[model samples]
Target: MGDPTAEANRGLAVGPFAHDGVWLRCALHCHTTQSDGMLSPAMLRRYYSMGHFDVLAITDHDQLTPAPDAHSEDDDLLLLPGTEISLRSPESGGPLHVLGLGVNAMPRVPERATLLETAAAVQAEGGLAFVAHPWWTGLRSDELGDLAGVTGIEVYNAGCEVEQGRGDSAQYWDTLLSQGLPMLAIATDDHHYPGFDAFQGWTMVRAATRTPEAVLAALAAGHAYSSNGPDIHGIWIEADRIRVASSPAVAISLLGAPPRGVRVNAGPHGLKQPGDVPRGADGRRNGAYPGNLLTEATFPLLTGSPYLRVEVLDAHGRKAWSNPIWLPARG
Candidate 1:
């Protein structure tokens, strides 16, 4: 976006374009024994904090579970209150999981049968609502066109991926964005089992402090990036140029619907193998290699670009994704 205020109006405030905040590693969605998760409340907290997470939202299904008492008063780990509501998505004929973060109580939905209205109700209760795992729910992009009041979608769901291999929802998020919606994207572990599915996906929220309010405020303000592994340092856009800095990656790409984006590969002449993996190496031996690694890059932002978001592919196929920065209308 050309202007920060205008971009914020369109839900484009997450990037490092004049943004001020410390990045907090946040696991916005997960469960505990309060739901189907294998961990108890106390153990869940230690698990996430031990995993290096600064914030955890205990989002058990349809119920707000109080975070267990922290063992140390000096611990900086912030535990946010949340719940995962299972709403029926009539369009998709499946249950939609909607996450309500930073709310103490459940929202009242006028029509419990409708996902959109339920999401709005959650927002009315002062919670940031997001569509969780659209791909896992088998939702179509057009279905989200009619949905509103959602802060974002869980673009990568670790549980969904580990369980059935249908975790990546970048395409679903892009479809909604292509429809002219400012759809924020966040990756979450959706951890149910502690060691297996936990810690696979996470969102890095930029906030002033490691508190529930600050973290949720940053999330609502779109100040975050989703990741499976790599970290995003900064994203700055000037004129037609966009620059990105992050952990070493094989390629940094500006992604949109189709041919409207750019990719900067680490090797010259696309020298990088499709996934940048070496032959007969332990990496992706039977599957496609992930990609190569470079720490930083800058590229020209294309005009008429509907939406541009950064995607960094690490050597292990893990990725860090920035929320879309919707460009102002082309004149």
Candidate 2:
């Protein structure tokens, strides 16, 4: 197997688990009354604050929502100036939503800009652009494969999931990855309504400080993970294997190219420890093991696998996803 540490040092690193930084819970995509959201900007801030989010970006549609001029000392929430611009995809002619996070101001583009034009505009304004909910937008993997200057895609969107069954885009992500695009993925609430769609998903960013600039920088560097409930403590890649430590989960999977992944499920035989086969409360092996009993796992790196990412699924079906760790080709 190849040495993953060496590959990471060569600038192919994804997770920042070995780095020094604080993990900030971030809501990267959402709206307020400024767009078609239920809450106003002030109320949205308070909602996320009460939910214990450390950073937030109010990506109102077609317009930038300015951050507050001043915040109270007790208010530690870092608000980033952002917007969600709608662009036309030449392949499909449908609207493509691109999130512009941390832009100083909205950029100038044609009324019906292409995805490339939109991404360039967002980047020109010093913002990071992300393709939001490609599956929900009915975008084919081929259409998104050649994208440039875009940071990533939303692998899971709570709003789309709740409203329709088209939110999980991991398949599209894998297709893109198989084609050799080093793309990142995020899970978001894309929240428009409270109670029903808020706090369903978020990104945990590793930043040196609790400021907007720091958070944006961390995101641009791919120092983050997306989750709905499970927490990934760490992911380490060694010479011959990859190890993952996470909160108690029902399953931990290392996903890679087709036919090149590993899944560890906490079944009736829990870790198969000497006497750890779980039994039902009635004292029978009826496969009633506690769902959140598997906390850590390791898997050998598959030879010829181009890239690998980790997914941790908890008892409640919530999942946390790591960005891909691209592997170096063997000489």
Candidate 3:
């Protein structure tokens, strides 16, 4: 059997990994003095640029922060127009914060628009809308499962993590995926305070170029991964197995439908035999062993499994998450 094309694969949506592109480190959600953040727009730009971010979106509350008229010749950072809006959610009868990345025009919607309505407006303005910190917002998985137009969810928010213990939302992402929602996930600092909250989480995008259009197109097509730490170099979905390469990690996991997932761990006492580990094209074990670090792994794809996504956990417990690779349904 051969690898399936995306169209033949039906519900499958693999991000930029399937193609050749430059990996862009992106900070998609953040604030500046225009809103509640401490830094002004100019200062915020300098801060992220100095942090080595390739792209940034200053998503201040309820208003669009224009990108700088021109970046210095020495600065290669790409800035995207963005904003954060609070819409009323019928499900929770409270605020639902949505990040509008690449939205140049302010959306026209009612003061009390629903998530569906807000998402439509954001999309209409040529932006991608993502739900921010569902866990911190006290949103239920069922509430998000059927929402149309929303791009994805914030799987990790550093600000939320620091203020409260509700930073991770992988559980919510898994629930949506299991229900057949091909939702993408992103990690962000949700920057408010500089020294305390910045650089904690970010999304890595694979784009052919650093232009705003290319990055936005990549994100809209689900060609990105989210991480607080750790880096996913590549993910190859094959006919019967999924292969992954990443920065050195202590654990690599393939998460899917109930009871269909698998995990590989590296420890001081590694696999009983080095021969038991998969080999790479270089004819060496895919990852290091015995010293408690890993760089690559391969896992069998269970037949009839709904979807498969990867998670890489470093020694410090930080994680990187890949978007789901949906498999075609069989009779």
State which candidate has the highest lDDT.
Answer: 3
Q: How well is each residue in 93-174 modelled by candidate 2, as lDDT tens digits?
A: 6768889999989977677677778888999999988889888888876664347888888888999889997778888888
Per-residue error for 66 in candidate 3, Å, reads 2.0
Write candidate 3's Cα lDDT for 1-331 as tens digits: 0122223333222456675677899998889988999998888888899899999999999998877643466777899999999876568766679998888698876777877888899999999989999889888776653478988989999999989978999887887778887678889999999899999999998887879999998898888899999988777665566667777787788888666667776653334455455322111134445454777676776556688888998888899999888777642
TM match of model 1 to true structure: 0.86
Q: Give the root-mean-square deviation of each candidate in angstroms.
A: 7.2, 6.2, 5.1
TM-score of each: 0.86, 0.88, 0.89
Instruction: Provide the clashing-pair count of each candidate structure.
Output: 6, 0, 1
Better of 1 and 2 by TM-score: 2
Which clashing pairs does model 1 show? 14-222, 249-293, 249-294, 250-292, 250-293, 275-291
| Candidate 1, residue 311: how far the Cα is off, in Å | 0.1
Question: Which residue pairs in candidate 3 have backbone atoms (N, alpha carbon, C) closer than 3 angstroms, thus clashing?
Answer: 15-223
- The lDDT of model 3 is 0.79
- Best-performing candidate as measured by TM-score: 3
What is candidate 1's lDDT per residue for 35-141, written digit by digit as tens?
A: 89999999899888888888999999988898788867656688888899887766767878889888757777655547678777788778988999999999877
| Candidate 2 similarity to native, TM-score | 0.88
